[model samples]
Target: MTTQPPPRASRPALAPRRAVGSRRALASRPALLALVVLLAAGLFGTAPASASGPASAASAPARAAASDVVAQAPGPLVWADEFNGPAGTLPDPARWNQEVNGSGGGNNELQYYTGSTDNAALDGSGNLVITARQGNPRGYQCWYGTCQYTSARMTTAQSFTQAYGRFEARIKLPRGRGMWPAFWMLGNNLGQVGWPASGEIDIMENVGHEPGRVHGSLHGPGYSGGSAVTGSYTLPNGQAFADGFHTFAVDWTPTSITWLVDGVAYQTRTPADTRGNPWVFDHPFFLILNLAVGGNWPGPPDGGTAFPQSMVVDYVRVHAPGSSGGATGAVTGLNGVCLDVAAAQNANGTPIQVYGCNGTAAQVWTVAADGTLRALGKCMDVANNSTADGAPIHLWDCNGYLSQQWRFTAGRDLVNVAADKCLDIPSANTAPGTRLQIWTCTGAAHQKWSPPAG
Candidate 1:
């Protein structure tokens, strides 16, 4: 969870136990409010007037169509929070741990986060409402002095963590200057590795000053704070995201992380995008949701600002690997030859090769949701985790290693995640026992493959 900046400055290092300060600037309050009012009235079609209202029925079809276009993860639902409890109830204690603090979020923020239902609670209508209200009634002392605002920040750190898959949430953001709402994630090893080093994935963050835009960012060792790798999506026609609900999601794979809003992909980051810095995202991470008031990036609320602003959430969901859309059959390459394990071997380091398709057990391959290609109870792996051309492909025990990950590109190339290379048939050889290797992706016939029909 972090703040938005005018020049993409450093964001708050948001975690349950710690806060790190950073500065950022945004548009003047009056101009932003005017823009938001105009956009909300003109661009929001059939959307609810307020976050507390029920979802519009007329928008269901469009949402479903948009979902159909999204490249959904081939997995089953592993975790979710629908917030269907009685009104005024807290979030499920089993899944969320609400943080209580007056630490200012390290961004010079004004809100003192609390575990009270007044700050965060479930509506009878299936939504998690995180409200930012004026006046801290608890007499909480903040970093600077007495707290002037109160809000809620919740996390799934103690309940769940996953390495790779789909993480998403549907949220209706709050508006007014100084309101900052976010749905994000942090590495589960945060206690050990600490901020930035533990990695931060800001799936969606919207500052009140920019009601029409939301940002997605990645923070790591060298590219953290104001220097984080980030991108923003602006609603067309000056539409304010606060006018309705939008789904924010990230498809995290072994090699890439793709950001999507309302089912449309806008940006994708790969290991290569790190600028030679270590990619620290290949590990388990937990989720966080918060609505902050008056931070460094958004400044403080002005005269036009309203009280009891709520960031309403419809749901938060996670999908596990290999729960859907996988095939188990012949994985054919050039000349329709099947990818096979030598001698039907199940031992580690057994060569993976090309052989005439004979419907044999050795030819059977399963495209796994975690990006690994499996056969004979083993994954197709790079020999010695090598990136050099002609590094042999072999069978190894199924492990969540970058060397074992593969992505079937639109161009039909089977690329390795760790090596950033292609699975190749050396010399374009058609021999039945030709061993496969990792080579620079060349878009050649020898590097093409057709995975089994799903």
Candidate 2:
């Protein structure tokens, strides 16, 4: 949350969690049910996303029966704030640093932000509640003359920040007039360079005037104030964002930023989108959470506004994306067809065929963090754990067997760890109906593969 009214740069230099994993899903959803049955039958699926691309259906982190993917090894848990403490306690000071001020946040907000419990506290219900009260609660006076409200703003500026990857938070927002709540970031250069130059990323922001929609924007050197690059996302079914908690995230890379709300990606901003503007987002940034009263964007609260409003935060997580160095997508070979499950079938000993790429899910593949190339939650394996050069490959239950663990190297070979042999197409055939088998590592074109383009 910035001090408003500055030329989009009140200390323009801005800001910028962990390994709290999602719980293992039970037999509650039909998709997961498919996973359980398949795993039990020793069958896993293959690329169904189409031949042209990963496909929109397979994007957004692929949550369909995702629990079944079972990360070969879960990515490193960098930092997390689970907010699991009894009610009325402060967030772990070791992880969170609070900002205390009331200078209207440059946005002409009315809250005299406080560091006291009256504003920020964890409810006994596994949530960090950042409450905004209309009147003073702890008798602490406002920084401005007779301010009418008080709130809390928390940050991880001094604790943690990563250059790139995934950052997410699950939050149920507050409602009513004059409320301005946000989860966002500022560049780490704020103290040295200042606003716009330091940059700002609004991961999630909601104004009381727009309860059904949340906006994501970026504030940089030339695009500050009302002119910042911004966009809005409205919940379908006429659902008010304040009705329930939703996950907000941004997958940042050197070239672009993709925003997701509730696991659905709605926007992707690339260098091309702001061609003339300087891209300041390539640096490190910190995180901030705050609920302001009467910010300029939402105008001042009217009589209809509610007091004691709170933003209930469920969890914040940051993950270090696992190795992709190049082994995690489609496994292609001779003739450029993909290594596929015959007819996209999932069964024990389902022959691994070389078929024309249709971008089908069966043609897609993922080399897990643990070096296992899997489809439909099952790994590519050598039949009967055979090591002979002619041994066939098939879709078998993923048992973490050496036969199931395959590794891809720049040498262009898929080496089965259990067999120490490479995947080969018989006599370097280029037919769509051919099946590939294990063969001595030859560094041949038949042993080569290319992953999906970013």
Candidate 3:
């Protein structure tokens, strides 16, 4: 059972939890009164808002205005919150709510969820704590009779749901027998047909028993756990999970959702895997945070499991394309695309085609972290290593071969390693098949290609 920390001067208060996986969604609840007071009192006074852009007065950090909540990686931050205060006071209620009962949720777990302030609360030290405490046995009750345990489930439903964007969270799991902590999302269109049909994205999930590992999984028609598309990573040995917090992320786009832990990506899934099952991930989904006691997946809590155990949520964030709808990074700048056996199937000697960006073995390209592109396990060399115009680009095994390394100048021109010849876009801006030839190094805009953003 969670031992309450010694009480200090009273501070503020927040949300609650649930046992079922599909409890609540939508992360748009209004900030509670205590949270507002703490915020005004500058609990985050100098701390930077969890978001990426300029800090606004309304969303001041509960700590210091200059203190940033966390680090940022790829994509732009659209929304986020660092629970830097105690439990009780959470983000605004207008953004969140608790889901009651099973709305045909993806998981077949049992539990009728309810939203109660008691389930979620803030402890004095800056953590949005969600605790699952054992409740006294009531009866075969529907209306407050016999109850064994209670927890919190929070979500961003009414306000901040999005389709095709990266969503992430930094969290510390409650270490106890039976404790279940999850950061996930469900398709926003659940009011109609509901689960599998609605789609579910599990960005991060951990059972108390196995604290050092986390799983990134997806569930849809024909592919739920036991057979769902899933991947997991274990932390370095001796690194206790309770030691610190880690960031878990999912980059959701029209084509796929790439999963990353810390900054390294480990898994990616595509629509093809579903056999055209209708990718429901292409729509908006509400964010959800919950801590549960027992479930079919982890089975029931073990004897070692303790009650009143709390999970600490640091923050949740989402990023999307910029207003101009422009690309984020350069595509040509990429060394070569990683391709799998399926992607490598091209007529021998046919020029390679640029397919969607996937981390698949086929699509994996080695770009020098310093900025040179390598392709097909070799440097992209100008045909004949020539510096003259109309030089064809060819692939040869590495020999430190001058013909093999061609540097892309500011313009799309590829500068030959052997000579100064540039890889020019013949008749620049032609259709996709236009052959790439070498010419004098001339700075032109047509030679550059930026990878489209998320």
lDDT of 1 by residue, 1-454 (tens): 3533222112222453222223232332223334444554457654333221223543211111111112233356789998999999999999999888787765777889888999999989999999999997679998889999999999888889998888889899999988889899988777776676888898988888889988888888787767777777676668898898888888788877877666445567888878899999999999999998887677899998989899999999887653223677887899989999999988888899999989889988887766678888888878765557988999987655556767654346677755557899999997989999999877699998876765
Regions more than 4 Å wrong, model 2:
1-75, 137-144, 322-364, 367-454
Cα RMSD of all models vs. native, in order, equals: 17.4, 15.1, 20.6
TM-score result, candidate 2:
0.61
Candidate 2 lDDT over residue span 85-152, tens digit each = 88999998888887777667666678887888888999988899999998764555554577788898
lDDT (10s digit) by residue, model 3, range 16-83: 22122322221111122234445644764543322112335664322211111111123566787765
> CA lDDT of 206 in candidate 3?
74
User: Could you say which candidate leads in TM-score?
Assistant: 2
TM-scores, all candidates, are 0.60, 0.61, 0.54
Local error of candidate 1 at residue 343 (angstroms): 42
* Better TM-score candidate (1, 2): 2
- List runs of model 3 lying over 4 Å from the truth: 1-73, 84-87, 100-114, 137-145, 322-454
Steric clashes per prediction: 3, 41, 86
Model 3 Cα shift for residue 377 (angstroms): 16
Q: How many backbone clashes does candidate 1 have?
A: 3
Question: Which 10-residue span in candidate 3 carries the lowest summed lDDT?
Answer: 64-73
Please report how far candidate 2 places residue 394 from its true position, in Å.
17
